[model samples]
Target: MATVTTRTVEYPADGLTMIGHLALPAGVERRPAVLIGPEGLGLSDVERRRADALAELGYVALAFDIHGGRYLGDPQEMLARCMPLLADPDRMRGIGHAALDVLRAEPRADPGRIAAIGYGTGGAIALELGRDGVDLRAIGTVNAVTTGRPGEAARIRCPVWAGVGSEDPIMPPAQRDAFTAEMQAADVDWRLVVYGGALHAFHHPPVDHAVVSGVGHHPRHAQRAWRDIVDLLAECLPISG
Candidate 1:
C-alpha cells in the first residue's frame, strides 16, 4: 500500500518551495533511486516513514525538503533555520545539488541507480552529496557532522556508509577521530558503523522536546541502521528487475 508521490520542488537557491516525497516500487521499471535528506526538523512524519520504508525496498524514494514549508516547533526556531543552512558548506553543496536534481529527474529514476540518504541535518546533507562530486552510486549517513573541509575527504566519489553513535554527543570521539582520519586519507569507499550505546538521533524516534534537539532513540540502532541502509543500497545500486 505504498505508491506515494507528492511534490513541490521550486528551490531556485532560496525561493524555497521544497517538499518532495516520491516512493514508487511496485512493478518497478527503472527503479533504484533514493534521495532522502530530512532531519533538521523539516520533513517530518519520520521522514515520511523513511520514504515509505524505501518504497518497500525496491527503491525509488525521494524525501527532501530543507524547510521551506516551514515547521519549527521552536527548538530555538529549528536551530535558527537549520544552523545557517548547515553553516554553509557551499550552501550544503547547493542543497545537495538541489536534492540530487530532484532524484535524477524522476521518470522512475535510474540515472545509473542513484543513491543518497541522510538524517541529522539530513546527515549533513548526505555528507554534502558525497563531498560534492555527486554522481552518487552510494552514500548513507545517519548521525553526520564533519564539515571541516580540508580537501573535503578528497571529494568522495561514492561508496560511503556511515552510521554513528558511539554515544554521539554530537559526534564525539574526537570528531570521530577526525572523520576517520579524513576518510582514511581520502582513499574513500568508507564505512563507519559504531553504535555502542547509541544516542544522537539514532535513526530518529522519541522526539518531542518541542520537536527534537535531543532525546535519543536507538531501537537496536534503528534496526541495524535499516539493515545497513539496505545493505548499502544493495552494494551500490544493483537491482535490475
Candidate 2:
C-alpha cells in the first residue's frame, strides 16, 4: 500500500480565510491531481478521506473548504448560506479558483492533469469552474446538477458526470431535466446517474444529527457513486500504475 500524508491548508478567498485539506501520495515527482469540493456544510472527514483515497491512487488530492472552516450542522443554516451563494456563479468560481490555486501550488500536482469533484453546493462550484473555462480533465458531482449560463457552459472543455438520488426532492425530475437540457444545449460531453430509491445526500455517511426532509443515506448507492467517480478519473486522467 502506498503511504499518504495530509495537512491543513489555510488560504484567502472572498475575503474569508479558507481552510482546506491537502493529501498527497508519497513521492517527489508531480502526479495527476484531483480537487474535492465538500457538501454545503463544510470540509468534513468524508471529503478529507476522499482526498486521501485519491492520493493513494497516486494523484495529488485537495479537499477544499466551503464555509471558511466550519460545518453547518443545521439544515436551515446550511440552506440560508448556500442558497444565495449557489445563485452567484462568480462567487462559486472564486471559491473553486481559490482551492484550485492551493492544489496546483503543490509540487506533487500535475497542473495539466487535473479533475474536480464535489458534493451538493461544492458540486455546483465544481461545475462553475468548468463553465469558467478552467482546463480540467473531467468534472464529477454528487447531488449537485446545477446548471450555469448557457453561453458560459459552452466554454467548458471537459466531460461532466453527475449523480443524484431518484427520490431526492432537492433535485427532482424537473431540475434534472433542466440540468441535462443545459448540458445538451452547450454540447458538453455529460452523463447523469439516477440512483434508484436513494435520497438527497445519499452519498454521505449516516449522521446522527437531524436533517431536513428528503435527506437520507444509502451505503450501497454511495459506494456505487464513488466507483463511478473513480472510473471517470481513470478514464480521463489515468496515471501510470
Candidate 3:
C-alpha cells in the first residue's frame, strides 16, 4: 500500500470556519478525489480514518466538516444545529461547495475526477451538491437519503448510490420512497440498498460517550455497505492499482 499523508484543513462556510481532515496518496501526481461527509455530529476520527483508507487506495480524500469544528455528542444539540441546515438547500449546498473547493485546491487532487460519499447529515449535503449541478462522477450516502426538490435532481449528471437501514425510523419507508421517486422522476442512474436489520447510523461504531435513539451500529451490514460504496466508486471512477 502507498503511504498516505493526512492533515487538518480549514475553510469558510455559512459565516463560520469549518475544519476538515484531508488525506493524500504518496505521490504528488493528480489522482481522483473523494469528498467524505461525516454524520450529523461532526467530522470524527471515524470519518478521518475513512479518508486515510481512501488515500491508501490511491485517491485523495477529504473528510469535510459540518459543525464548525465541534463534535455534537449530544443528540439534541446535533439536531438543533443540523436540522435547520438540512432543511435549507441553499445552506447545505454552500457547506458542501466550501469543502469541495478545498478538496479541488489540493495539488494532488484531480479536479475533474471527483466523487462524494457521506453519512447522516453529511450524506444529505453530498446529495445537495449533486442536485446543485456539481460535476461529480458518483454520489454515495448512508442513512441519509433526503428527497431533493422537484426538478432539482435533474441537474445531477452522475450515478447516485444510497444505503439505509430498513428499520431506520428517521429515514423510514416513506422517506426512502420519496427519495427514490425523485431520482426516478429525474431519470437519474441510481441504486438503493436497504439493510434488513440495521438502523440509523449503522455504519458508525458504538460511541461509548453518546447514545442516540433509533441509531445503532451493525458491524456486518456496515462492512457490506462499505463494499457497496467501493463498488460504486470503482464502477464510476476507475482506479488502477
Candidate 2 lDDT over 5-59, as tens digits, reads 9999999986789999999898788899999999887889999999999999998
Residues 1-241 of candidate 3 have per-residue lDDT tens digits of: 7889999999999888999999999987889999999999899999999999889888899999998899999888988998899999999999999999999999999899999999999999999999999999999999988987779999999999999999999999999999999999999999999999999999999997765789999999999999998888888987753
TM-scores of the candidates in the order shown: 0.32, 0.98, 0.98
List per-candidate RMSD values in Å. Answer: 16.4, 1.0, 1.1
What do the candidate models score in CA lDDT, each in turn? 0.77, 0.93, 0.93
Error of 3 at 164 (Å): 0.4
Q: Taking the tens digit of each residue's C-alpha lDDT, what string does model 1 give over 109-167?
A: 88777888888787788887777677788888888857547887687888788888888
Candidate 3 — worst ten consecutive residues by lDDT sum?
A: 232-241
Model 3 alpha-carbon miss at residue 157, Å = 0.5
* Candidate 1 Cα outliers beyond 4 Å, as residue runs: 1-22, 25-32, 35-47, 50-59, 62-107, 118-135, 138-140, 144-156, 159-167, 182-184, 187-199, 202-241
Clashing pairs in 1: 119-123
